[model samples]
Target chain A: MSVTAAKGFTAAGIAAGIKENGNPDLALVVNNGPRRAAAGVFTSNRVKAAPVLWSEQVLKSGQVSAVVLNSGGANACTGPKGFQDAHATAEKVAEVLGRGAVEVAVCSTGLIGLLLPMDKLLPGVETAAAQLSEHGGEKAAIAIKTTDTVHKTSVVTKDGWTVGGMAKGAGMLAPGLATMLVVLTTDAGLENDVLDEALRAATRTTFDRVDSDGCMSTNDTVLLLASGASGVTPDHAEFAEAVRQVCDDLGQQLIRDAEGASKDIKIEVINAATEDDAVEVGRSIARNNLLKCALHGEDPNWGRVLSAIGTTRAAFEPDRLNVAINGVWVCKNGGVGEDRDKVDMRYREVHIVADLAAGSETATIWTNDLTADYVHENSAYSS
Target chain B: MSVTAAKGFTAAGIAAGIKENGNPDLALVVNNGPRRAAAGVFTSNRVKAAPVLWSEQVLKSGQVSAVVLNSGGANACTGPKGFQDAHATAEKVAEVLGRGAVEVAVCSTGLIGLLLPMDKLLPGVETAAAQLSEHGGEKAAIAIKTTDTVHKTSVVTKDGWTVGGMAKGAGMLAPGLATMLVVLTTDAGLENDVLDEALRAATRTTFDRVDSDGCMSTNDTVLLLASGASGVTPDHAEFAEAVRQVCDDLGQQLIRDAEGASKDIKIEVINAATEDDAVEVGRSIARNNLLKCALHGEDPNWGRVLSAIGTTRAAFEPDRLNVAINGVWVCKNGGVGEDRDKVDMRYREVHIVADLAAGSETATIWTNDLTADYVHENSAYSS
Candidate 1:
């Protein structure tokens, strides 16, 4: 169950001939709702794709009836003509759905600096619209995949409402949003203001903290739409919790399927002077190339950890820093403590705890190990 | 020619049994002069090695009699005991040379968080002192090699004066100083203040701009010692230029010898609003893993370059950015320009020019391509 797990939603995925390999490359999700309340977050990168520029304006209206996504060409840095293509695609989707052009949001992924094949894409949109069904969520998830090896979906159901979503990203996963396209649907009868607040709060911790690599994308987008089909108004706090749960689950799935990653690393910074300091320190550790390589080799090299922390502006005395790798406190008070040889790292998951001994603030950032396959996959082609 | 290329200096290198493989691991350089004016720079990383902490204090007097460097272990994150060991090493050198302990500076490179073996190190200082000679500069350079495949040295002879130095580093090379140890000696009769000003100016543009892998070290140190043997004080501007030339040459050597690097990339950011902005954008592009991988595969993926520029806070409009790879403009005005297929990247050196079109300021950064061999080397064992 993907987005279709929630009521009043139908989706479809179809091959659009955009990719030469004949893979499914077009997806459409529509809301048959009494209320079309929505919220969205786009990439923080200043160099945005044409589709992102279109979607940002569509999200400003806070009412989206449908979302059209494709995987082939990013349509980014393509100048004014690319924007026109996005506008025209939205217009076609609106014409078929009997909705306004402004009510349709567009998202694109794949290679940057290339224009989409509008002749094939326009026809594929009509085919996708014809195939729209309640059980098409999985198909839609499968279609919006470029290098992703598997499709991702998450569902969280409460007493009378359900929140569900889908995501696709295998690389270029970093803060300021990973290279991803996520669409969440709910039937909990929420208004635009509530949906916006909940989506922002949920994504701030989930997608914003997952840094598989220190590279941001130009087409990152996360949209949350409410159809109000359940006709049950839940408490705002409870509804926010359900949205956060779904987002957290999807974020984990993205990390598990990260490109060429052999180990999933969880970096937790504790006792920071502030939440921002914790985040800064956590990101510094997450983006350290040497430390990531050492962890990939299962070396438990805590010295590299201390060196990374020292590069940050976070408040912490060098002599007071402590670190634990996989439950072994190998470094204490900036010196050797437990034997590093005693630490076990035979699994796909690695946990590191860095204690600042400064205050009570804490944060966690998810990342992946740097491997030979990562270099090989990213080097072999332009993705 | 190495540090001893100048007059009134003697040096030696020997295996001190600190390295288990019995490679040369200790070096010594002495100033036999009427003046011992000196200036030094160390790593900006806060979690500094014990030798760095000790040498920082030794340089406060603006005078140095000798320098002792080792390659077997980096005594960092070892608490008070490490500091004591650094002090003891200085005392041993001072005793053997009949000088005050405060006049001796120490440097160390290799694995961090481990203590140096004083039993072998102290006796080795006596052996180095006994073997010191003006022709031993090449041997001293070889002794400071950790993972460096070859020892590096540079010399510039001017009108009645000479400047020469040696450096050793293979990885963990980044800004705020690469993981390197360099020593330069000049026979010109100059005071400490003049030496300090010229050394800082030289390093600001040379060593500090070399970012091989974006990983700073805790044991980086560069020192300049002046002996009054030449009895000729050259023009300040000419002296500074000679020093900068030597540093630039040594920095290039470090990048060429970078671990597992198949290509060296030079990122030039031009027409920025300020020098700081140019440097920031250049570094952001230099540290981009995706761009590095693309260049490693000889693919002119200029879109990745645009994406990296977007992440910086530099002053530039997205639609005005331009990028050139190997003199071919692959991206212009933030969109596609010349055909990427026309660009040639068969050589080991790649040049990337980013035109910000904001102002007249410019900066350059040197880095290396991300390779599977890099992962293999860093993962095979701890550095």
Candidate 2:
């Protein structure tokens, strides 16, 4: 159970003949609620996808009865015709579900610059609505995968309410949003404003910090819907913590399942002048291809870390900086410290701590190593 | 002849026992001039190498008698001892050449965070000074190789004047300077201020735009020395053009010899709102890992180009964006246009043009395709 774990929700996933390889390409989630409330976040990339534009408008009404997602085409950079297609998709879903089009959201993922196969997708919406079930959450999670090797879902329960979510992403992952589609559900009887505040506060530190590739996408969207089935309006802080926990779990899953990744790196920047500075330093370290390659080879190259930090405008003194790899302080006071050979790196997880020595702020960024397999996977992806 | 193509320049290269493999690791280039006028540029990286710090201070006087370069260790991130070593190397070079220590510049390249072998290096400087000859430019070029497969040199001869240079760099290349050491010799009877203006203008469009792997180095230095032996006093514009030509040639050589690169890509952004905008967009396209990998596989994935453009704050509308790969406009009006199959990419040189349709400014950046070999080379480089 993903969305349905929170109660008062049903979902369906089906093959819509949109994918040439006959993979499941369509998913629908519906809220059978005494009250409907929703919040959403989209990619900050200026060139947004057609479904992103449609869903952004639907979310403005602060109510969502259903969400339809497909994984065979991104429907991005497709011009006005693509936006029209997204609107048409929402209308079709509304017709099948007996709801207003404004209460339905649409999402798409996969190859950009191609129009979706409406002929197969429109009829599949009826078939999916006819098969809606509480157990269909897992299938819905699986249907949104593009290069993801496994479906990701996480849940957190309180005394009387719960929050759960599913995410799909593997490559082209970065900040503002990764190239992903996420749907979260809650039965905490919260209004749209409360949901919006909690969702924003939770995602700010969770999904927004995952910078796997430093590549922002045009079709990233995350959404949350409340059904009020539990009828318990919990404290805002507790509900927000649950949302953050689920989002953090899903983000970890995204990083662990990153494309062709051999190692998952966690860069933590400490003693920064401000949170923004810490984030800047963390992102710079996360995006350094040379450093990533060095980490992949298990070389404790502190110089690459220093070079990455030098490129940022964060507040830090070069001679006062320090770096630790795998809990070994390989560099201290901007120079060689402990013996690098003593650091063990045979594990799949690598942790790098960069001390800015400026103030008392910290931020963490998650990334993966640069490997030959990454080049191979991306080089042959479109062809 | 390389630097010796110009008058009043003598150079020598020798195996200094600094490299374990007995490869040539020390080079000395002396400007035997009646008038010694020089200008230099160093890496903008805040965490600069000890050699870079030493050379930057020497260049402040607008006079340089000689340049000493080594390839065994970068002498970076080594703290106070490294700075003393760099100073000692310069002092030894000045003593051997019978000049003041302030007139000698030292450069180093290799793995960072290691101290130089002063015992071998100081003795090698004396030997290099004794063996300096007008025909040693080729050997001097060969001595500075790190991962470079071949030596790089360029020369431009004009009426009674010549500008020539030698460069060494194979990896860790990006804007604000590549991981390179360049020494330019000119016998055109120019002042340090004139040479400074000319060198800055030349590098701005040439070396500063070559962004391979988007990884800046801590040990980049470019120096130009004028001997004033030709007695021509040629037109300033003509001399500047000659300097730019030589710099452009050397920059091209560096790109062609970029480590593990199989294809050279020229990204030209046209019709931008400003030249800065064009440069920003061009650099963004040049540094896109997905686009580079796709180009390596000969796939005209125009969507990646659009996606890269979307990430920048440059002035361009999504629908008005167009991209052409290898002379075929694969993406027009931000969507699919001409057939991608028509864009032939079967050559070692790949050309990409992004039309912003915003203004009339233009800029070009040179980069290389990402390959498995790049990962292999950089991953095992320092290990």
Candidate 3:
């Protein structure tokens, strides 16, 4: 179950022939409800995709009746024609659902700088609308994949309400909001403001910390909708927590399915002067190609860690800096400490602790190891 | 001809037992002159190596008698003992040359966070001092190799004077100041302040723009020594031009010999609001891992380049940007333009021209492609 797992929602996924391989490339989710409330987040990249620009405007009304997503072409960098294509896509969805054009959100994820197959996409929206059902979520999730090895979905249920979501992205994942296309739905009674507040709070910590390849996407977007079908008014704290948990689960799935990744690294910056410093230091370490390669080879090279740290402007005494691989302190007081050979790194998960010794603030950044496979996948991706 | 191409300089390189592989690892350069005028620049990294710290102090007097360098172990992060070892090495060189310890400069490269073999290194300096002669710059350049495939040296001769230099570093090369160790010798009669100004201006545009691997080292340094043996007080502009040419030539050599590089990429950002903005944007493009990988595979992926540009805060409108690869305009006005298939990339040198469409300011940054051999070389470097 995905977004359609919630009450008063229906979804359908179909093979639109937009993909040259004839795979499923279109998904539609509709809110069949007495109340329509929605909130969304999009990529902060200045060079945003056409769909991102269109959805940002539609979401301004704080109400959405349906969402149309396709994954054969990103519809980005197509100039003014790309903007027109995204508008036509949203208008097609609105006409099929019998809703206003401004009440439909749109998303596209695939090769950039290419026009969408409007011939296949516009007709596919009509077919998807006719087949929409509450149990059609898993199909919708599977339809929105480009290089992703598996579909990702998460569902959470309480005594009287349920929250469900799905995501699609295997590369170009980094901070600055969602970093991918995610759609979530809940049956709880909530207003647009409450939904927006909860969604922002959840993604601020979850989706904003997953940096798979250090390349932020231009088509990243997240949407959340609410319906009063369950008739349960959830507590604000409880609703926020549920949203965060769902987003966290989806973020982890995205990382696990990251392209050409052999290892998942968790860089935990501890005892920094401020939360921003912790995050800055952590991001620097996560983006160091040399350190990422060392992690891939399972070499406990703490020198690379220190070198990365030295490049940052974080305030700390060089001799007071400490680093640990797994649980062994390979670097203490910024020098050789415990035997690096004693630190075993034969696991898929690598934990790195960088202590800045400035304050109590901390942050954790998720990244993937650099591998030859990563190079191979991305090298020929666009061609 | 390298540093020894300049008059009044003697250099030697010897096989120091400090390297367990029985490779040549020690070099010595002596300024045997009537007038010893010297100036130096060092890495801006807060975590300075012991040799850098010692040499930084030695150059404060605006005079240097001799310079001793070793490449087996980088005497960094070893605390007080490392400083003591660097001081001891310089003291031995000064003792053999009959000069004060403060008149001798020290430099080291190779694995960080390790102690130098003082016994082998101190004796090796004496051997190098005894063998120092007028045409030994090539041998000195070869002795400082860690992962470099070839020795780097450059000479500019003009009007009865010459400026020559040698550099050593294949990775961890980025710009704060000089990101690698270099020794330049000149016979043009000049005062310490004149040489300092000329060297700074030369490197600001030459060596400081080379960002091979985007890693800043703790042991980066560049030294300049003028012996006043030619009795030619060259004009300031002419001397600065000669210095720039020499540094430019050596910098190119460093890029060609970058570890695991199959292609040398020159990212040129033009039409920026300012030179600093241009430099910032160029460096960002040069350091993009995905773009580098695409270059390694000969894929003309302009989306990665656009995504990289979007990450910078430089003043440029998204819709006004244009990019050309190998003289083919793949992207125009921030969108697709000419056929990407028209671009040719079957060469070792690749040029990327990004037009920011903002102003006339421009800058160029040099970098290497990301490859499996780079990963293999850096991963098992210390082991």
Candidate 4:
């Protein structure tokens, strides 16, 4: 299962002179199919990008056949001009593919509020269209990245059904609905309602649980398209689980590639009175910069963990909470229980478990350790 | 004014060996007057620290003669034993000062959930008692620091009345209520109710508007003591404003001293429909790490400003919002309108203004720019 493995899909990526480094800055994915059923989830931020606003309205018809994405210049905050540029790109893609403009989706990332270089972007789109191929998925994935050191792609397969996805986001991640740009493709037939349900459920625990820096993005979007090429549609529960698996995998990759992050951390909260409470507890810890930095330094600072958990409204007596760092129980019943020296956080993966001793509810959040590199990358980002 | 500038107060600082570096860790502040009228505030976190819990109970009587604070171990989650240590510390202070144990307040800050070093603490208390003086405020301020680059102090005087305070907190300073450990002294003759009202009002607009990293501490406490030695008490309104001024000054100093901070940022939200709306908008921008980093780099990233403002429930039309970074109107009517490069951010201070176009209500928040030093400081902490 690959981004272009689905039937009737062709993809291409190329250097568009948008990025300073001249890396692949343009990507295009096309659907040369008889069916166009699409759904998209956008950022919950009220201050949305012009492209997001345009696509949000366009996707209301539940039909999308192609997507045009570019890096190095986020066509956001450009107002009417930005909106027109997005519409023009969609029209250009539709003209080349002999489809209506409304059937095309557009996504842009990079420095915000910058106007797109349409001279380069239009020709780049043409070049991408001319070079479109089924094996272009990997290149497309590499084209949409900003500070990410690695490309993220995932695919799920089960009994004649396939779901492939590619995502790009390294910062401005926090729990809400979506935090980045993701395109998912499936060859299995799915009703609009089924797709919506599966997408929402998949995002609830995956993309919605990643808080890299607790900064929500304005251009975050996730689109799902079903081609029904496999002629096999699993039940709703099964299909939802498969989609969740894909989202989970992609979400993990996003965290691993977080800006200046050297380690991926998982914060798990268990035995909460309610799922929301558990999630709140987990997210609170995930968003704590001090805790993230301490984890980056391989310091088992259980005090920060307890302090973070204490800020949440979860129903747990402080003394009844047990905390484990790196698989070593450093705190039990709200007191020092294990030797601090026993916890080793020298690797690129760190895990923290908190038992609330209330009920059988749990939540796990993915995050990245805060480091000087993160500060450096972000501090100098806009310059 | 200094910590010891208040009449009838004696203070001392001593090394307790609790910190590995053997820095001055134990501090004592005593009120020698017969009237022990005190008002206090604790952290807003539901998970109270042991010292917070003990002090909360003691402050219920509105009488406190002395406060004993120790840095290096914030005995927050040490369970019953932690509470015992706090009580024992207060008892030792009371015994040394010949006051009732119930009249003593205790506070601790540093790593959490560790047992107190009884040998070091007890001897340190004795040494502090022996060294107590009317001019030990600077020493006490330096004693209760953890990762703080400098001490914070503020004083306000009107006529024959005086109010002075010292605060210690550099991080974990998001607002629920209070975010640091502060002690205020006054020689004005005021009742407990007046002091309480003034303290609450001052904290609401001061400490409550500072968001360093969006993390709230468990051991945050603020104590206000009035010795009535000045034999002069101004009107309640005038005294309250003075207290607010002092708190505001200290709050600004705290933001300036934020870990790895290179610039102090002020986010002002104006034309909100209500005060709450204005505060929410201000806080959203103050908590955005990307925006903070952009400020650190002196880049006028108005897109991040809009995205952050969009996260709040403030009743404002997105398209009607206007934004200015460092006095340069970078965005007008929710879109870029001015030359972003015209904004100058070469100074250590920054000002961001968001016009909601709803009403006349306004709120301002103080924050710090994210920097590599912040990451390094927090990452290496506890290591």
Candidate 5:
């Protein structure tokens, strides 16, 4: 199940020939519903893709009937012509669905600074339009993948309503917002205001905390569409919980499929003076090259962990800090503690707990270990 | 010529079993001068080494007679005992040189979170003092090498006076003093105030611009000692220029010796709205993992260059930015321009020029390409 797992949505993926490899490169998801309301989160990078610039405008209108997406070419840094291509994509989707251009959002991912093949992409939109079906969510998810090894989807069904979503990303995955393209669909009769509030809150905690490779994307976009087909108005708190669950699941999938990573590391910062301090400490550890390398080697090198934390400005006394790796407190009071030999590293998941010993706040950020494969994959090509 | 190239200075290197491999791990540089004026710079990292904390106090006294350095272990994150160890090392040097303890400076590098072996280090200082000579600069430089394959030193002789320096760093090199340990000595008859001004001005542009691995150390220190034995005062502007040249030369050497790096990359950000903008953009490009990997593979991937620049807050128009790789304008007006194949990557140096088209300010940051060897060296064991 993907975007179409919720009621009143149809999706399709088709070969667009945009990629020279001739893989499926076009995807369309239509909200054929009694209510067309949506919310969106986009890349915070200053250099945005043309599609992000266009979708930000469409979301301002507080309505979205469909989304058009493609792979093989990220229409970023292509100047006026790139923006025109994205606008044309939205216009074509709106024309096929008998809606206004402002009601459609577009996303593109692949190599940057290149223009898309509008000749094929625009016509391929028509093919996807013709084949739109409620059971085509998986194909839509697969079409948007760049280096992702697997298509990701999640669904949370309540008593009478359901929330479903699909996401695609594998590299250039850092917060803000991980080069990911995602679409979440729900059939609970919520207004545009409710959808916008819930989307921002869910994304801030879920997608915003996953830092796969410490590279921010220029084409990250996550759109949440409400169709109101089930006519079951769930409680606001319950609806938000369901949406968050799907987002959290998709974010986990993104980290699990991160490029060339052998282990998934979860950095949990506890006893921070504030939430910001916790986040700062967590991010510092997540982006540390030496620490990530040691994690890949499974050395349980707590020294590197302390060094990474020392680089951050988080509030904590140097001698009061504590670090535990996989339930073994290898470092305490800023010195060597338990036997590092007791720390086992036989699993795909590594849990590192950094206790600041300053306050009661805590936060967790997920990242991956650095490996030779990461260097080889990143150096071999322009992906 | 190294730290002892200047008049009235003596240096030595010795081994006292501090390093398990029995390599020389102790160095001493003494200024037996008519004027013992000095200035220093230390790591800006919040978590500083014990030696850094000790030397910062020494510099505040505005005079330095000697500097003691070691390569076997960094007294960082070792708590109060570490601080006491650094103090005792300095006191030992002071006793041997017949100077006050407050007039001695200390520097340490190697692993963090471990205490130094005082039994080995203290006796090693006495051995270094016994063998000190004006011709022992090269030996002192070699003693400070950790992963550096070659020792680095620079000399500049003026009319009747000379300036000389030595630096050692192979990894954990980044801005905030470039994770280096350096010592410069001059016999130019300059006072402490003059030395301080010139040292800060020189380091601001030279050492602060090299970002080899985007990792800052907790024990980075650069010290300048003035011995007025030549008795010839150079012009203020000329003196600062000479200091800057020595720093720039040593900084370049540090980058060349960076661990596992196959290519030296110079990222030049030109035509920015302000000097800060230029430096920010230059540093962003220097730290980009994807672009570094692309350079390692000898692929002229200019799109990655643009993507890296987009992640910065520097003033630039997406449609007006231009990029040139090794004299080939591969990207112009934020889009593809020259044929990427025209660019050559056969050399060990790759120069990237980014034209922001916003103003006249410019800056350049030096970095190194990411390689599989980098991963292996950093992952094989914790430093």
Candidate 6:
């Protein structure tokens, strides 16, 4: 079941002439509420997009009824007009759905700093809202993508509760809480405070740990809307765990689909002085492009790995650190230990384990190998 | 005139058995001064090579008479024995020069965490000392290269003084400095404190600002040695300026020879509220692989530029950001303005200007385009 399969939600996607390719560019998702509890996470980048700023303010109410997203023009750095365009989109959505304009949220992705073609957008929202249906999650996922080869959707079912989500992102992925645009829906009865707490906790570990290319986006956001339609609120702990699993699954898919990526790499930092240190070490390695490229080539260049980990301020002595790639111990007690040729990287998945030997804490980060395709795709992205 | 041109200095480069290619992998430089005075800068990475730690300790006295470098093994994370190897190298150099071991420094770069081949290294040092000469800067530069296609050397001549240097690095380059190994010599009468101050200031603006691949190295070191042989001491201001020019020239050379780089990019962040903010903004843009790749493809994707700028903590409203590429104003006040066709990126050099509209502070960072060759070269770097 897709995200829209959740009770009390309807979604629609449509072509709006915003893209020159005539692909679908508008998506609308509405909460058929038994409850309107909602929470959101936005990009931490100080330079934010117009739609991000607007949504951040709207989310202050901790309540939302609908979301309107458009792809093709990011509506970022478009000055005051960009904000106006976002508000106008919300107003149009509210007008069509007979709801307050403030109850609608907006997101835009594609090229940044370009004015959204209002001529195509206004009518497109009306069409999307009118065509909204219970099974439109897949279409909505496909509409809000640029350069992504496929749509990403996930669902989790419990005894009496269910959680579902859709995500869209191909590049500009990094840490800052939420790294991309993800919309989650649930039929379990949940309070606003509980949903907010759970989302923050899940995001801190899941979406926040995916670093595809270490480029943070201006429009990254994640929103969760709980309809309480099932009237069977599971234990808060169970719901939170389920939410994390959904996010983890979708995050993995995003990494798999990273632009020009051939392999997905998982870096685990263990025996750290603290959880934060472990995460910092993992992130340091995940963001190193040279190491990532080396992984793509299947070269167990532990030197690059050591160099990456050394860049972080995490507490660890170089001599005590241990490194293993693909389960082969390449270095032990800070020195070469295993034959590099014994480690193989022919598969699409790669794992690297770094032992800090300082404490007991551990953390893992997911990333993709840097490839020539990534360079080729990005170099001509704006052209 | 090069680094070795300084009076009271003898240098040599020779091929040791460390590298499989049989390239020149060992180098020796000695400061033939009545009173040795030196200052060094090492990589800020927390994970340091064994030689780095050893040298860092040996440089505490601010007096170094000799430096030994090898380019086939990093000797990092090799535990206590690695430290012994570095000390032994220094002892060997000192013994041949008839000086104390404490007065010599050591550096290594190449594969990390591998034990030094003491059998080959000991004999190689003796040969290097026997062959040391005044005009060995060219060979010394070649000795410390890994993937670099050419040697990098720079010299500056003032009214009564001269400063010259050589460097080796072609990959694993980024802010917080690149994976560079540099040796500088000056035929100027200066105190240890003065030389340290000049080196710091020069490096902050030059080597510290060139980020080729955003990967910090564990064995980055830049050492400056001053000889009173010239008997011509100039004002501190003049000496500092000369040092800056030499560093700038070498830094540019490094960028020109960066791996697989089709274009050298200069990113300028102006009108920032503070120098730190300006640098942060400039570095953010320089480190964006997507933007670098876009520059390679000659696409004026200003959206990517603004998006990269948005990732920094600089104080600027998204709408007020102005960006120009290749002298053409592609984005003004945060929105698309001039015709993108007017911006041409066909040349090997590209300039990007970002106006923060905050204040007067500014910073410039140098970088290279991301290409397929970068991936291909780095993938097999260790093997």
Best candidate, lDDT: 1
User: lDDT per residue, candidate 4, B266-378, as tens digits?
Assistant: 89999999999999999889888888888888888888898888889999887888999888899998787789889998999899999999999999988888888888888
> Where does candidate 6 chain B have its weakest 10-residue lDDT segment?
B374-383
For all predicted structures, in order, the TM-scores are 0.99, 0.99, 0.98, 0.97, 0.98, 0.96
Candidate 2's residue-wise lDDT over B146-264, tens digit each? Answer: 88999999999999999999999886779999989999999999999899999999999999999998888999999999999998898999999999999999999999999899999
Candidate 5 DockQ vs. native: 0.69
Cα lDDT tens digits, model 3, B325-378, are 999999999899799999899999999999999999999898889887887886
Residue A118, model 3: lDDT of 93
lDDT of 2: 0.92
Candidate 3 residue-wise lDDT, A25-72, digit = tens: 999998887678999999977788899999999999779999999998
Quality of candidate 4 docking, DockQ: 0.80
What candidate 5 gets wrong by more than 4 Å, as runs, is none
Please report the interface RMSD of model 1 to 1 decimal. 0.7
Query: Order of all candidates by lDDT, from best down to worst?
Result: 1, 2, 5, 3, 6, 4
Enumerate the candidates' DockQ scores in order: 0.88, 0.80, 0.68, 0.80, 0.69, 0.73
Give Cα-based local distance difference scores for all models: 0.94, 0.92, 0.88, 0.85, 0.91, 0.86
C-alpha RMSD of each candidate structure in angstroms: 0.8, 1.0, 1.5, 1.8, 1.4, 1.9
Off by over 4 Å in 6: A177-179
Best by DockQ: 1
Sorted into a CAPRI-style docking class, model 3 comes out as: medium
Q: Could you tell me the TM-score of chain B in model 4?
A: 0.98
lDDT of 2 by residue, A46-117 (tens): 888999999999999779999999999999989989999999999999998899999999999998888998
Q: Alpha carbon lDDT of residue A344, candidate 6?
A: 90
Q: What docking class should model 2 receive? A: high
- Residue B314 displacement (Å), model 5: 2.2
State the lDDT of candidate 5 residue by residue for B1-383, as single tens digits: 79999999999988878789999899999999998999998988877889999999999988999999999899887888999999999899999889999999999998877789999899899899999999999999999988889999999999999999999998678888887899999999998899999999999988999998788888999999999999999998999999999999999999999989999999998999999999998888887888888899998887777777788888898878899999999899988788888999999999999999999999989999988888888888778
**Candidate 6, residue A201: how far the Cα is off, in Å:** 1.3
